[model samples]
Target: MDIPFIDLDAQEKVIGKKLEGAVETVLQHKKFINGPEVSVFEESLAKFANVNNAITCGSGTDALLLPLMAIGVGEGDAVFVPSFTFVATAEVVSLLKATPFFVDVDMKTFNIDPEILRNAIIASKKMGLKPKVIIPVDLFGQPACYDQINEIAEEFSLNVISDAAQSFGAKQGGKPVGGLAHITSTSFFPSKPLGCYGDGGAILTDDKPLAENLMSLRAHGSGKNKYDNVRIGLNSRLDTIQAAILIEKINILKNEIEKRNLVAKKYSEEIDKKIQKPIINNGNYSAWAQYTIIYENRDQLSEYLKDKGIPTVIYYPKPLHLQSAYTVFPRYPKNLKVSEFLSSKVLSLPMHPYLSSAQQNFIISSINKYTKEK
Candidate 1:
C-alpha cells in the first residue's frame, strides 16, 4: 500500500459528526456571508490563544496584511523578517509599499536569529531607514525566539507580528504561540493542524482599537455598513461556512495536538542520525506541522523513497531570496548562506496527527534503508 503523506481522511473520520452538523447548519441558514458562525469561531479562537481579540480573514496572507494596515506599516517603514520563511511573511510588507529587511535564522529552531535581527536593525539605521516592525514566522509549527526578539523590539520600539501560520496550537513554556507577539496571524490551510474545510485565517491581538480596524479592513473598510468604505482595504472576510466548519474542529484541537506530538516524537526517535532530525526549543512544544529532515544528498534520498512507495516533499526547495519574485531585495548575512544551504537539503516527510503506527514504521524503514546504502 502507498504510504501517503498527511492523512487528512483519518481526521475527517474523527470529526465527521461535528463537521456534518456544521455543514447542515450553514445550509439551513444560507448565511454564506459574515454570519453567527463567524463570530462564534472568532470567540473560541481568541479564548484559546489567550488574546483579547481575534479577527477572521479570507486567507493567511490577508491576516498579515490586515494587521499591517491597522498599525500603519506603510512606505518609508521597514519590517524585519527572516529570508528563510514563506513569501507571505515578507509579501505583506511589500504590499503596503514598505520595505522588508530580510534577516538570518537560528540554525536550531529555523526561526529568525535575534542577534542577526538586532544587527540588521542597526545596519538599517545606518542606511537611514526606519525599522518599524518585526514579522518573525513560526516556521514549521515552531515559534521564533519571541522572548529575545520581543526584548529587542522593546528596546528598538518596534512592533512584533508573529506569523504563526504553521503554529497556531503550539506552545512555549506553557504559554501559547499566538499570544507571545504583539499581534499574531495564523492560517487554516486545510492541512494545518487547526484548519477549516476551506481557505481561512485569523489575526489575534490584545489591542482593541487595532482589532476594530482589522475587522473593518476585512470587509472592504466598511464602517457600520458593507459599502461605507471608510478607508482603503481589501475584501478579506472569512466565509461563514468555513468559520462554522472550523468551530467544530476546534473542539478536538487539544487531542489532535497530542497526537501530532506523538508522531513527531516517533519520527525523531526512529530516524537515523545520518538524516538530520528537527530540533525543538526546550521551552517550546511544536504543533509538529511538518516532520522535516536534512540530508547531504537530498535528490538521491528522494529517488530512493519514491522507489519504495513513500512520498516526500521539500518544504522550501529554494529560500525566498533565491526566488524570482524576491531576488531583488537586499538580504541579511549579505549572502544568506544558511537560507541557501537549507533550501537544497531540507525534506519534509509525512506529518499529520493521524499517521498510523504501521504506516510510520514503513516510512522509517524505507528512510533507514535509503540512508544506509553503500
Candidate 2:
C-alpha cells in the first residue's frame, strides 16, 4: 500500500459514524451558514482553549487578519514577525498597509528569536517607523517562547497576535496556545491538529470588546446586524457545514493530539543525530503537527528517502527575505544567518498519529542504511 504523509483516512475510520450523524443533522436542518452548529462549535472551542471568546472564520489567513482589522492596526505602523515562518504570518501585516519588520528565529525551535525581535524594534524606531503589533507563529505545532515574547511586547507596548495556525491543542507553560497572548489565531485546515473537512479557523481572546469587534469584522464589518455595514472588511465567515464537521472532530481532537505526541517521541528517541531533530522546549507540549528535521545534506537525504519508498517534504526551501514579493520593502536586513541555514537544511518526514510501529522502524532503518551507503 502507498504510504501517506498524513493518514486522514485512518482518523476518518475511527470517527466516521459520529461524524455521519452530525452531517445528517445539518442536512436535516438545511442550515449551511451561521447556523446552530457554528454556535455550538464556537462555544466548545472557547471552552477547550480556555478563552472567554472564540470567533470562527473562513480560513487561517482570516484568523490573523480579522484580529488586526478589529484592533485597528493600519498604515504608518509596523508589525514585527519572523521571516522564517509561512507567508501568511507576514502577509496579513502587509495586507493592512502596515510595514512588516522581519525578525530572525531560534534555530532549534524555528520560532522567533526574542533577541532579534528586540533588535528589530530598536532598528524600526531608529528608522522612524512606529511598531504597533507583534505576530509570532507557532510553527510546526510547538508554541513559541510566549513568556519571553509577551514580556517583550509588554515592555514595548506592542500588541501580540499569536499565529497558532499549526498549534491548536498545544500547550506552553501549562496554558493552551489560544488565549495566551492578547490575541491568538488557529487554523482548522484539513491537515491541522483540530481540522475540519474544509478550511476553517478561529480567533480566541479573553477581551470582550476585542471579541465584539472580531464578530463585526468577520461579517464585512457589519454593526449589530448583518445589513448595517460600518467599516471596510472582507467576507470571512466560517460555513456551517465545516463548523459542524469540526464539532464532530473536536470530540476526538485531544486523543489525536496525544497520539501525535507519541509518534514524535518515538522519532526523537530513535532517530540519530545524523538527522538533526526538532527541539521541544521546556514546559511546552507540541501537537506534533509536522515533525520537520534539518539534515546535513537535505537534497541528498530527500532523494535517499524517496528511493526507499519513503516520502519527504521541505517545510520551506526559501526565506521571506529571498521571496520576490517581499523584496520591495525598504531597509531589509542583510544577515539572517540562522534563517538562511535552515532554509537549506530543513526537510519534513512522513508523520501522523496513525503511523504504525512497522512503518516507523522501516523509516528509521531506511535512513540508517542510506546514510551508511552515502
lDDT of 1 by residue, 1-374 (tens): 58768887888898888888998999999988988999999999998999899999999998898888988888778899898888899888998998888888877788899999999999888777888999999989998899999999999999999999999999988988778999999999898888887899999999998888898888888997986889888889889989988998888898889998999999899988888999998999998888889898988888888888888999888888787877776667798778788888888998888888999998998888877873
Instruction: Give the TM-score (vs. native) of candidate 2.
Output: 0.97
lDDT of 2 by residue, 331-352 (tens): 3355778888898999888888
Q: Give the Å error, residue 28, model 1.
A: 1.0
Model 1 residue 226 distance off true place after TM-score fit, in angstroms: 2.9
Report the error of model 2 at residue 270, Å. Answer: 0.8
After TM-score superposition, the amount by which residue 169's alpha carbon in candidate 2 deviates from its true location, in angstroms, is 0.8
- Show the lowest summed lDDT stretch of 10 residues, model 2: 327-336
Off by over 4 Å in 1: none
Going through the candidates in order, what is the number of backbone clashes in each?
0, 0
Q: If scored against the real structure, what TM-score would every candidate get?
A: 0.98, 0.97
Each prediction's RMSD over C-alphas, in Å, is 1.1, 1.3
